[model samples]
Target: MQRTKVKELLAGAEEGKEVLLKGWVRTKRGNKYVTFIAVNDGSTIHNLQVVAEADKFSEEALKDVTTGAAVAITGELVASQGKGQAFEVQATRIEVLGKADPETYPLQKKAHSLEFLREIAHLRFRTNTFGAVFRVRNTLAFAVHKFFNEKGFVYMHTPIVTASDAEGAGEMFRVTTLDPINPPRNEDGSVNYAEDFFGKATNLTVSGQLEGELAAMAFSDIYTFGPTFRAENSNTTRHLAEFWMIEPEMAFYDLQMNADLAEEFIKYIIRYALENNRDDIAFLGQRLEEEDKSKPQQDRQEMSLLEKLEFVVNNDFERVTYTEAIEILVNSNHYKKKKFQYEVSWGVDLQSEHERYLVEKHFKKPVIVTDYPKDIKAFYMRLNDDGKTVAAMDILAPGIGEIVGGSQREERLEILVERMKGVGIHEEDLWWYLDTRRFGGCPHAGFGLGFERMVQFVTGMGNIRDVIPFPRTPQNAEF
Candidate 1:
């Protein structure tokens, strides 16, 4: 017989039919009369119970079968005798595919701390939380591609090794072939010997937006969903040394259009996850309820697993200018007590706290804050008529401060050259990019959405590490 998914079988199926199932045992319960085992195959959230009589399957087989052991069972599906379950399989024949010794297996039936789980990432997926997170992560990624592909956006693969600092943050992980102990030096004592990878010096690309923009000019609509690297050492819930970014650049588009695309894109991703992974969401809900059974209903709603996503996906996101958001922050009593470390002026880069307040307290929804100061934004952003702000926007959601960062590109050759010079970015560094503007550039806009942050927001997973399967953080790359 063909193998059947546990979740599919439990949903609705013939009770008396024979089926073959495969998965690792999640838990095992038994009395003297019979034994029951719950197994998950990473197909869905639901686990199938394997019911076998003591006289039917040997006690030695049952004794050898522990949690985390992989097994294949040919059984007859039957209406579940267990409480709150729909269907179960009564094993006719059992096969032990792989045995995970109880003494050696890291994951057990007992609850493990997230930090402890992080140490055993190789086996972490066996846990329900990580399984659901990774599954939704996969779905969200699919939704991103589906949204862009359906809209005629050409997917472009930008280079991982590049010569330009797209964000100008100086946080690149350098890619070189030079000896660190006895490095070659130029006449002025600077690093020399332009014989690095691909001849000259190179490093990992921070954002694909620059190359993505070049592609957009030719393709009219283009996107890049790839891994971006940053060497920043800041340790926080949001920061990661290496993470994936989804960037979409469009030709003949303005800043407003960019913001609108971001809002709609996020909504689509959330809707996709909710529609396809309802069982995982429900499992998380039940776990939360069990974790805090005594909590009041009002308190529960505040931290419900799916409330923020439902709100953002169902409702229209709020849009406001950077100036207006600053005004609200200055006047609001809630923000008055909390002090910001950075300058709170109109042109300064808004801190994470300010962005969070705008979404969580003021707008009470996702807010698109646009028209940021040019000095605080990237060189590619189009300058506004006010002679100060750039046509830049950030999609700030309630839990995750800034989910998407985007801007309308400065297409004018003269204006872009001047902007690049003003930011101290060498014009020669971006000669090819400038050539595109001089030849045939149209008004273009694009944004970068942090993939892990999006997953963190959707799943209400507090740490960025928990969202990614093997999180790459500062000085930490354990499996």
Candidate 2:
């Protein structure tokens, strides 16, 4: 018989029809009169209730039906007598496909701490929280592609290994095939990359935006969605050593257009989650509320999950300049009372605390802070007429600070080379990148949205690691 997923079964499959169900058991209750089995196929957050008569199956078959065990049940779908469920399967035949050793199985019906779940990452997918998280994640990812495809943006596959540091942040994972203990050396005794693979120093890409720009030049509009690496040693809940980024570059666009696209893209994905994954999102919202209850009252959020998503889609993002944002923070009561950890300055890079204050406290909405100091932004960002600041923009959300960063690139060849030199980057190292400006380069703009951070924002997941299936951190590479 063909099998039916838990999701379909719970959606009220025709009653009095024989249906086959295959899935792992979530929970099992037994008495002399009857046995109740909760089965889940990872199709939905809800488990399908399966009822079996005491004498329906053999003792050995019934004994193996435990939590984490895989089972197949052939039964007749009927209206559930249970309160919460609408339909259930009345099992006429039961078979144990695989059994989880009851004594050895790690997962139980009870909730597991998020930290403990990380250790058992391999098994975490079987849990409800993770199941819901990944399901929502899948939908959000699909929504990203759908949103861009409908807008005529060509998806570009950029190289994963590169010699150029796009961010010039000096925090990139080196990619090499040299002997670590004893390797090639130069006349000066430094490690010589001349003899190594790639014929020069190379590292995992920090961002595809650079190559993405090359594609945009040809395709007119392009976007990249791929994994990016950073060697920064930050072990906070907000940081991940390896993550994914979505960058879209468009020719003939300005900083304002870039900010508008980011805002529209984010809201599109959030709205998708709100529409497609209602049950899973609802479960996550309740989970977040429960988690927040343990925090201090002052740390509690102002809006609920559904409400936050709706607010972003329905309202316009507040746009301001870095100078204006600085004034707001500097004049705030927190700064006046000396409660701000990082001092507010016109040219200083805004920290997480400052960004959160602007989004969660001051603006109470998503805000796009633009025109940051040229010194603090990437060299490619176009220099404004004032010459002190670049035409850059950063979108900050209420809970997640700086969700998107982009800029109107410097299309002027001479100015770009001068800025690169001022930042100590040799022009010879980026010949092709310079060629773009040397050729028929036009005014263009783009921005990068960290994929994992976006996932954390939509899921209400506190830690960045929880959103991705396998999280690589400073010292922890365990699966």
- lDDT of candidate 1 over 69-129, digit per residue (tens): 9999898998987796789998988888999898988888788988999999999998999
Question: Model 2: residues >4 Å from true position, as ranges?
Answer: none
lDDT of 1: 0.87
Evaluate all candidate structures by whole-model CA lDDT and list the values in order: 0.87, 0.92
RMSD of each: 2.0, 1.0
User: What C-alpha lDDT, on a 0 to 100 scale, does residue 247 get in candidate 1?
Assistant: 97
Best candidate (score: lDDT): 2
Question: What's the TM-score of each model vs. the native?
Answer: 0.96, 0.98
Model 2: how far residue 100 lies from native, Å: 0.7
Clashing pairs for predicted structure model 1, backbone only: none
- Encode model 2's per-residue lDDT on 369-440: one tens digit a residue: 999999999999999999999999999987879899999999999999999999999999888999999899
Candidate 1, run of 10 with poorest lDDT: 297-306
